[model samples]
Target: MPDDFAPTPTTLTTADGLSLEAQWAVPLKHRAKVVVAHPHPQHGGNMHSLVVSTLFAHLIGSDCAVLRFNFRGVGRSEGEHDFGEGEQLDVRAAVDSLAQSGDAQCPLVLAGWSFGADLALTCDAPELAGWFLVAPPLRVLGDERFKAAPDPRPKWLAIPERDQFNPPDQAQVAIADWTNAEIHPISGADHFLVGRTDKLNALIDSFLSAL
Candidate 1:
């Protein structure tokens, strides 16, 4: 039930004792809980940001629980940006909190947008069911790790054809190493895919189905 969903806001604390705010939505019954990542905090990114919010709404149907949180230094999260170093830690910690609390083998999905995509590739969680990345900046990713990432966990890259930040030609080269990875191109959209909520939801639904 990863379509026709809903959202709920909640808060959780980091290992360093800082408070991080998030939108936590679940189906009527317990399902897989997704740990979502946001874009760069310095660039006005938060859980409520347009694309991230749209994704969370799509994942919280009758079979899943979606958690979209503000990374360190954004919104209610205490502390400042770690240039992706500490941010990866924050994502891992969020995953740990959920796993340690008894959510395991529930098809954990790691998803992010733009900057969030770059940072999420740096994680090393074996339990991760998939990586959902949109508008990832190749330069920001800084290496071939994303390319060489093992295929037991698949990857989904969403790129807007007209995205000023990441064009098709560039995305083609960046997505070279992903075996199961599929990059969906959208027409007439920017990096944020403005005015395309319905399309985004459909794409997210398809991803959930494959899992």
Candidate 2:
């Protein structure tokens, strides 16, 4: 990573008083601010997950401040995983961290992959301007826990055509009633999204550019 885009290690304190490990990169002139969440913790996901790290690098390169963090029990982050329940607070802490840093008026968006994507949908932070979800398994948490589906803010979903967890068609049906939500299917990509980071990054760039 270039010196200008190097991430600064930090810690985020969640509402439940747990300290989560995190890394934040701020560009010289940021166009927007973003908080990136990794996949499931039990599945070996953390701040350094491929998709999360790639998005962090791409966002900083595009002159956007970005933050990526490990969930409660993952990596060096404190506390145990409360399934998708306590994780919501972790996401909110990330959003709060970015909101308090600099340029409070800049667009703040949340981007997540797989398990993290499902978790993001459950967060209804007022500071979040929108969301960008990648292959979210809409069934991870029950529908009753989801709060973003009806939100009027713009939301973009990058669904994988062959996703083992949730294919494009299933994702479409899941979000059919969601307000201001748009889907962009990635051809031939699966749930893991191996070798598809570039496309995801491009989609994110376009999403931020339009904000």
Candidate 3:
């Protein structure tokens, strides 16, 4: 609730000409700028999702400027869902929004949850410094679509041990050949990560520190 952490509601324009609803917060000083994407829009995901909001709450401080937004069709935003296809543009718009709102010299990191995680893997913008994925199903699109797999940028995956969609073991096989990527398992956590937010946040903290 502090003044520096207060989020300012904003809007983003995607390349294809859609206005997306968003909110961003910048601290008095920051080392990194982050854009957070929520889970599947068709499945009730939005900028206020627990994990997405957690990242917003945890990251917007003296060290980071954070932005969380609803995908094209999720909230007050315009345009319909495009599965994982057009959503990529939505992510790009978010990155663009944050880039213009914060310190351009600071590292830009993409943090996403579930379906949003898969979207993060598909974004190959040159501005991205790193990525943090939480319990990504990895089945939303296809392996060929994950542009970040071969990318050398730092990536951290928080795979839930008992995830209904993609467990730690399956996740391991999926990222076997990925470059500069690491997986941190959330023991006893399912895909929803009911009570494992603390563990997840810890991993985020570590990721931010490393950057």
Candidate 4:
């Protein structure tokens, strides 16, 4: 039903009165949804970043509603960046906003690229059906100080062939605890999947399709 969908711009205020700017490329007929998180806000990441936007654009015509939002201090969202702390709260707020759109049992997916992926794992909303993390900083999220990943989750980690942020050897050890987590390497792609979008899109599509 979503063969030719166009995303609609949206904004929602969280319980804390912070205004979040978002983009929703909802399916033409389906009501299920997915919320995407952006990269680290402190490093110039926002909802419009190339990788995040690509993820949003890749799923525009999918069966699930796709949501992408800017965190506090990033883009139109108010306040300064909290590194990962406030951003995690922002991600949960986005999840709650999407949950309120339909039945409580509606299927929901959470995806983040880079540091955003780490934030996605911070959201433990019981309503989420799955998670898709692209080029995540596994060590950063693994630190007990940041917080543990969502419980017993179904996750997909798309790592670039040569991501300098999280070394390949380190990633292998970091992903060991995730029972449903699977990691795939994109050949010749940088940490951001630079000039290899077609492969990135194909990988993302296959993951969602499997669900």
Candidate 5:
């Protein structure tokens, strides 16, 4: 991690009183805030997941306060797994926590990877200025919140070329009529974004910059 992006350890209490482990990275001056969610907790996803961590590193000096956390039942977070149900509250709680950080007036961006991406898409935080999704597995996510309406908020979807779950072709079909989502097909990237962290981070940075 870059010296400037070193995060401060923190704990967030969800609306249902679940304590979640998190890290907050804020530059000297910030113009916006981003709340990031990781992949499936049952699948070894956490705040430290490569994709999540890479995003944290990428936002180091971008004037954005970034918050990444482990969902319930993961890491030291309290409560059992609630599938994607209770996890929705977790995302909201994260947003609320960031809102209290004195940057509430700034644009708020939400981001996630795979399972986390599904949660971000289903999360109903109207305060969000944008949404960034990386390799979301449509088959596993049955939420209709995103598909039910046309959201005006900017949405960026990055589909890996060789994703294990959803590739660019499949992802395009799944989100064909999605609000204002702009899909980007990443070359040589997988669902885990292993060798494409740089590309993912760059795309995300570009998305945020345009906002």
Candidate 6:
């Protein structure tokens, strides 16, 4: 399916009563379901971040039900940003919204980019089938979560070869203890993935296709 697969705009209510703005598309077959988290709201990150947008557009018409949303305090979402802490509830709200759609039992995948990646890792959800983290800045975020209670679920780390924060070599070292993790280095790309979205989509598609 193409990127313009027509999304339905909606609102998600978090456990804490905050409402988040969201968009989603569900496939007929529903082979997989995915909840995509945007980058840091402190920056220009939102559900519209290129990486999150690209993933939403690419996965929409496929067998995956995709949901992307703005965190609290971003765009039309309610409440102020609690940094990454409250954002975790936003992620869970997205997952809950996706689950309310067709085939709630479908294998769910949690995918995030940059700051969103950190939130995905920190979110206290164990029902996810796997995780796809793109250009995560591991140097500054939750490293103990993976170390203290390393999840065995498959995790795909799509790192930019020249990432400004987490380079491929450093990423390898950081995720070494993540027993089921695999790193795929995107050639000639940066942390933002400015002009290499096709490559990023391919890497993510390949990872999900394998499962």
lDDT of each residue in 70-167, candidate 2, tens digit only = 99999999999888999999999998999888677789999899989999999889998999999899887998888999999989999988899888
For model 4, residues 17-124, the per-residue Cα lDDT tens digits are: 788888776554554577888887777888988888877776765555778999888888887777676677788888888777644555788888888888887777
What's the CA error at residue 99 for candidate 2, in Å?
Answer: 0.7
Q: After superposition, which runs of candidate 2 have C-alpha atoms over 4 Å from their true positions? A: 1-4
Root-mean-square deviation of every model: 3.3, 1.1, 1.1, 2.6, 2.0, 2.4
Q: TM-score for every candidate vs. truth?
A: 0.84, 0.97, 0.96, 0.88, 0.92, 0.92
Report the lDDT of model 5 for residue 93: 89
Worst 10 residues of 1 by lDDT: 1-10
Ranking by TM-score: 2, 3, 5, 6, 4, 1
Summarize candidate 1's per-residue lDDT along 174-206 as a digit string, tens digits.
667657777788777778888975676787667
Kindly list the per-residue Cα lDDT of model 3 for residues 1-211, writing each as its tens digit.
6787788998999999999999999877788898999999988999999889877887875478998889988889998999999999999999888887767788999989999999999998998999999999998999999999999999999998999998888888989999999989999899888888888878888898898
Q: Note the Cα lDDT for every prediction shown.
A: 0.72, 0.90, 0.90, 0.76, 0.82, 0.82
What is the C-alpha lDDT profile of model 5 across 1-211, one tens digit per residue?
A: 4565568999999889899999998665677888889999888899999999988767766777899999999989899888888888898888778867845677888889888888888765777888888888865457464432267788888989899888888888877777787789899988887888889878987887889
| Of candidates 5 and 3, the better by TM-score | 3
lDDT of 6 by residue, 1-211 (tens): 5344467898999999998999888756677888998888888899998999998888885667889999999999999988677777888888777777878678788889998888788754756778888988864355764421277778899999899999999989887767788989999999999898899788877877887
Residue pairs in collision within model 6: none
The candidate, 1 or 3, that scores higher on TM-score is 3
Instruction: Give the per-residue Cα lDDT of candidate 6 at 42.
Output: 83
Residue 67: error of model 5 in Å? 0.3
lDDT winner between candidates 1 and 3: 3
Clashing pairs in 2: none
How many backbone clashes are present in model 6? 0
